[model samples]
Target chain A: MNEGTTVLITGATGFIGGRLVEMLAGRARVRALVSAYTRTSRIARYPVEMVRGDIRDEAAVAQAARGVDVIFHCAYGSRGTPEEKRAITVGGTKNVIAAARASGARLVHLSTQMVYGTPEKGVITEELPRQEGGGTYAESKVEAENLVEAAAAAGLPATILQPTAVYGPWAPVWTVGVLARMREGKVPLVNGGEGACNAVYIDDVIQAMLLAARREGALGERFLVSAREPVSWRDFYGSYEEMLGFPATVPVRVEEAVEPQRRGRRWALPQLLELAREEPSVRSRLGNTFEGQLARRLAGPLFRRRSTPSRTPELDKLRRLRSKPELPVYRLSPTDASFYASTARVEIGKAQRLLGYEPGYDLRAGMELTGEWARWARLVPAKAEEQQAQQKRKGVEAQ
Target chain B: MMVGAGRAAESLHLPAAAMTAQVTTSVIADRNLERAREVARNYGVEQAVAGAEEGKAFADAAILALPHHLHARVARELLEAGLHVLVEKPLALTAAECAELGTIASERRLVLEVGMVRRRFPALRFVKRALERELLGGIRRVTLEEGMPFAWEVTSDFTFRRETGGGVLADSGIHVLDLLAWWFGELEPVAYSDDDMGGVEAEVQFTLRLPSGAPVEVELSRTRELRNSIIIEGERGSLEAGLAFGGALRLDIGEAPLLIGQAQPHASEAGGDYQNVRELFIEQLENFRDSIRGTSSPLVDASEAMVAVGLLERLRAMREPLELPWVTANTTRAA
Candidate 1:
């Protein structure tokens, strides 16, 4: 990638691809292939050529890849059903591979470390075989990697980069998502969050992608890109707690599914009340009706019975319902428990040696920067008192 | 007459106009004649045309729901043709353009209202009355946050482009800024920052000084779900109101929080009950009709709406890139 090199980036509206466009817009002639559904506010600021198209459109992908020297195939379906994910991850990769092959453009595919799945205990590296049944997202990535590898064997210039838990500003999963859960006090820690986290800063991953795009030796190679050392899951989320100025997450144990015991007829009204509380749409719909309004107006006085010496079970249920509903606790699923309990440490020595890639931001530095964004994004408050003091100082200076 | 049959005209203005007995929507116009015809058929309008010029003969008042960039030119045309115009929010892209429209409307003595429908919200009216009555004594600080995932059914890509007056600040910030100006008389821009590199911003944070020198912090976004509420802290107490058109207004003084106002049903002129957002739009339409009929003044006339436009213009002039510390020095140096 040089000053005059023309590159087409798929998923240019996404986090990684958007950042890539920002970094490359000034140095290279950047072209972005964006989907109509995705908002382009993040990347439309740059002087990059935007081509509206989805990766599944072969003609559109080829059109965007035309006259370009490099193709950054970063688009993947993160949402939707399994079939939709497969269509985008596997089928879309097929189209990208075809386009890359036809245009003779160097392809750099973004894969995930989840291809290795929840390995029991080992130093995970690029040489390890990708597991088969690692759920929809991981399986899709594995299948996509297979396509890229097949294309590489057929003499198409391609490089695969598997990043582990990429987290930084604008990161949906590890940064914003974690902060939201932590703020709600719903962050569930499986077995006290003792799992090893191969957390990598987003900029470092972009650096690896750039190196892979430019380095001749990176072709026909797959690299596991991550920070130098792994951090514990507790430490990973703990950094966010420190930024938030309070501890909010709770620890929960992993257990098998349990069936609810049947209750007598007295529990029916309480169950209905719980359901109404859980679903606002249903509650609102019922509340808007004439009967519901009349019932609501009368139910309060009807259920206001004082505790008597011979209280009935129905009265006790009504009294309990009158009290505040308990907040539901977050519990990790079996798969999530297994994922958060993994002890495997991902190694990035291959990327370091082969592509001259070095992690620019360590865990502490990355979290510090992330904290700045979190405050700026208002994910965590920049404390009202502090902001007022700063404003007052600025106001005085202006005066 | 309705110019530009886009999402707002289809869902909001048309439905509200149908409910207002004094207002009759006679014509629907758009550059794309098919869209105009479809909307006209759905709304049961008498005629569809390719441009406002063709539709002007059928109606006395026109609702200009065109894109933001076209508001000034189209409204000027309609006002010059001796028609009352109700343009959508922000009036125009710049404060000067908004002022120019106001000048034309005043010169012709036509009703030129801006569709800042949030001004008609019951909760907002309650908050304004509370402030006027000094219920929350001596306002100290104010913070307003409004955000939601970008899910609007836009007819074109203009909403995401800067040249078309797109961005969260222009689209959503206009409503909030107008509310602030309505509450606390003139706003002076303090500082402005946004997550924009060279394109439109999805998220922005800025500060303004009210007439009393109190700092007003605003954060608007089209990318995430925020608290979506406005909090005004005062020396005596505080008030929190929903940023949405149908949000509740709450007063918090130290004891249990009291809900001052929720979605209360109000009787319309036609003797029908309307509530929440539906009532908001209906009130705005009725106000526009009454302004045209010389029975009442516009809630948000062109000149009054320009206050927000001026503040936005100044904020954009002093805009700084929001600090993105996660961007490595290497990337910055490369750029």
Candidate 2:
């Protein structure tokens, strides 16, 4: 794509979509289609044009698509029950496609790897069929991907990019859930658990999309963008612990089917299915089949069955990512603490080879050195005390 | 006798016939029983309530508004007499004296209250509520500057003397220190040092350690020309409140620097000091009444006030200017 080609973007005010606008601003003529609800700040500095309208509105989407060469349709969620997800992700996609077709624009749809559900063994690829999954978030994304496939069949040039676990500076999930919790010493690891997850930094995900956008061969195809190396949940936690100069405590485990667990089952597929069933409108769409069928079909029969000790061997084979642990030291003792450089390992090779991508910033260095905050205000004694507590726990566990 | 009675009736601001109807009265009770009747008549109370013997039978509730030195003895007597009591600030001359009074009130099941008027101050209450909501986001540091002129210290007796809870600390310092302890619970004295005006602390500066390791600095003096203010610096914002000038409070809720230079006006028509103090005293009285009725507990109960007294005692002792060990609640070994 050249500078003259206008790329129309929906959900441009969102975390991922905002970054995409910045990434494509200097490269292409960017037209950001932001919904009225998500429009927060007035765009002043970016080399982009803004169009404020709801994606659910067909005329508004058509207006946003005028004279655009590429449509990056990322809008989802209408703030309602299970039925809303179908309307927004499925119905919204159809409307977006019609607008894109009217303007003769190629589409790049943001898809998730969660559609594959929990993978059985080796890395799941783009060619793998969508398996049963949990919640409205997954079901809707799968449905949206189908709409894009249908659009491609109807001669609207479209491509799908499925990125797993995007994390960086303004990353919404990892920052709040993992990093913040790690800092506060409240992280929990499940079972004796090792669940391997592949994550790419947000910068790489944006790069991958840019590469796919320009490549003529990417049309009508789906691609998986990740860091290539997989990190187990156990070792991912360990890296955060290493950064804090402490060994984090293993969280206490309770029966998964206990009442306490049942009461607070946020994001559980069964609960979402129950909620979906109570609403008559949603049940009608699913043909009034008995409650739990939608959850069973989406989450698969294998997931519905109890996970047993038979899967333990397969889980154990996954390697925990190695991180440089805190060097044990007292004030008088000589220590190797100075020798350690804090870093998170990422596999940049796949991105480099496939997309001809080069990461502009040293992500680790950028993390260590940022805007103006006095580090001296956070005294070493306070940090050391926290580290000592973590080390003591680890010692007990080892014994 | 009839002429004298008529003159008294005219002076009382009531018709002669309805004089026995609800009497609009004011009362003043010091230790001297001889002056009680005279003071009560002058102030329009139908009868004088005394801290000493014999005068207790005539009053509903005795206002033991005596000097700091007389508070414990007089308050205990009033409580023993089965009448509720309102004592002056510092509650008593010593922390031990305060405890003794508290015990007497408990034994008699009578209402006893201290007059710490600043709790009812609009600015202070606003600051307190903001802290509770964490709107200021974990108070990283706090500073309190409170002082008054020597002219305002009209009494030369117990108020100016160190032995009678009359020093700058016991008199004026309690207000700011209590404010600090209430704003951030469980503060340990990190550092404290002060100057003496002929054996009384005329000036004091101290640093306190909050549970979060944040610093709370207090600067109090008796020589400065009447100033009372508190400034708090939070993670994302700052709050400033002043009591000496117009009783006006302003809060800036954003990252806009220290803003230390903002000056507030000293307006004379703002309000009267006694009116404010009287209202707070009424509030304290009602709270005590409610506690006795089992409807509500006293706001600044004995336990809470005892902690403040402990902090004040430590601050006063720290005035001698010595390198003190960090004496926290858990660190009795260090002590």
Model 2 lDDT at residue A152? 88
Q: Mind giving the per-residue lDDT tens digits that candidate 1 earns over B105-149?
A: 999899999988777666676678778889888877888889887
Score each candidate by Cα lDDT. Answer: 0.80, 0.57
lDDT of 1 by residue, A1-399 (tens): 677899999988888897798788767899999887347766766666778887888899899899889999889988799999899999999999999988889999999999988786679999888999888999999999999999999999999999999998889899988887766534545566777889998888888999999888899999999999999888998898888876654443332110112233643666655654664433432333334455656884643342123235564355334322222234454566677777889999999999989887889988988888788667887866778998887556434
Candidate 2 Cα outliers beyond 4 Å, as residue runs: A37-39, A42-45, A179-185, A191-193, A239-399, B1-335
lDDT of 2 by residue, B1-335 (tens): 00011122223212311232322333444444455555455545564444345566665455444556666776777688787665556676567767877888788777676656677665566667778888777666777777654434131244544555566677777767777778778989978876442334555778888888777877765544334678787776778888552355656668554433222222122222333334444455556556656687667755556667888877666655422111001111101
Task: State candidate 2's DockQ.
Answer: 0.01
lDDT, candidate 2, A278-375, per-residue tens: 54322222221222244446766654353233334442332111211121111100111110111222334544555565543232422232100101
Count of steric clashes across candidates, in order: 2, 2
Query: What does each candidate score in C-alpha RMSD?
Result: 9.4, 24.9
Worst 10 residues of 1 chain A by lDDT: A254-263
What candidate 1 gets wrong by more than 4 Å, as runs, is: A45-50, A102-104, A180-195, A244-341, A380-399, B22-24, B44-50, B53-59, B234-236, B252-274, B327-335
